[model samples]
Target: MISRKIILTFPQALLDKPIVYKLIKDYNLIFNILQAKITPDEEGIMILEIKGASRDYNAGISYLKNLGIDIRPLDQKIIWNERKCTHCGLCVDICPTQALSFKRPQMKIEFDKRKCIACELCLRICPVKAIEIQQ
Candidate 1:
């Protein structure tokens, strides 16, 4: 598996749209939205992790750039908030490959980002929208 990570800058307007989801589906590639940061100027910085063959990686990048995401590679840490997470277990159930899980006593969910296919099911199922995919 060839893995590539990219930091993208985009207009704030795109944030309101599910462009990332669309890109993932169109390319049939795997990705994880690590972080999303909003600037004072209303621009968005997104960190994304993608995995696939080399050709697929380049193709995915080209597709994203075509859609207007400024792509580059950088090192960054992504954080997930467990407090706002409802523990409804929607994310755990949605993982097709069982990449995420909920601990019984701790009542916390764990995400194995590498195992994620970037299906966006977790993001969609979180009723509170507590999970933020940052760049």
Candidate 2:
């Protein structure tokens, strides 16, 4: 039972209609939404806790990546700075796994380590390059 936390980033526009239920229905994995919030620029961010066999966990990540979702290991220590972010919402919009929410008026963001599959989208999309994956 090597459980781990995964962080996922998604577009805030999706929050107008959350796809989390669909993900649960499609993936058929037991998941809990630890944190959820939207950014002022309309980005949806969330943190998830996933538990299961290592094989199953990897399989789930593969499935999500195949679907074009952004997945990343949560063990990494990441820090966000508002000054660097341009509010372009690229990270929020491209997230396929619905792990990120930036739709809040304050542009608040949350991360769910369990749900992440380690796709590494945030690492690639962040313009200011604020997100980092630790381990």
Candidate 3:
């Protein structure tokens, strides 16, 4: 199966449509939502990971673009700067994927980029602005 992380930006007019639903039903793709903020009559944005066959994945992406959904591949990275981090663990609570964890013994904050889904939670929760997403 092909898996890809994507950031989807939907216009206010498309807010009422079942876009993700169609991606599942018609395109046969599995979508996992990492973070989302969608409201009717307002622009909606979502960070999602989609898994499917190569052909289906391509088709699904095409369908979204055809509907005017702005699709951006999450190909960059999220990183933690140890120099800026205080090891306070504030970012740990907001990370749903447990990508940010407190290492035992030292109680130091450790970031596992492999486990990160780029949800951007740590970026907002870090008071010191140590967490960064390299776009």
Please list the Cα RMSD from the true structure of every candidate, rounded to 1 decimal place. Answer: 9.4, 8.9, 4.8
Give the alpha carbon lDDT tens digit for every residue of 1-135 in model 1: 687777788887787887777666766678887766665457777777888777777777887788788776754333447788777787676555455788778877886666654434456567888665576
lDDT of 3 by residue, 19-56 (tens): 89999999999999877865333667788899999999
My TM-score estimates for the predictions, one after another, are 0.51, 0.47, 0.59
Tens-digit lDDT string for candidate 2 (26-121): 555567776565544555556788766666667777776665556665555444455666666776665556566575787766555554544455
Lowest lDDT 10-mer window, candidate 1? 72-81
lDDT for model 2 comes to 0.61
Residue 6 in candidate 1 has what lDDT? Answer: 74
TM-score of 2: 0.47
- Candidate 3 whole-model C-alpha lDDT, 0 to 1: 0.85
Arranged by lDDT with the best first, the candidates are 3, 1, 2
* Weakest ten-residue segment in model 2 by summed lDDT: 13-22
Highest TM-score scorer = 3
Stretches of model 1 off by over 4 angstroms after superposition: 75-135
Write out the backbone clash pairs for model 1: 35-133, 35-134, 35-135, 36-133, 36-134, 36-135, 46-135, 47-135
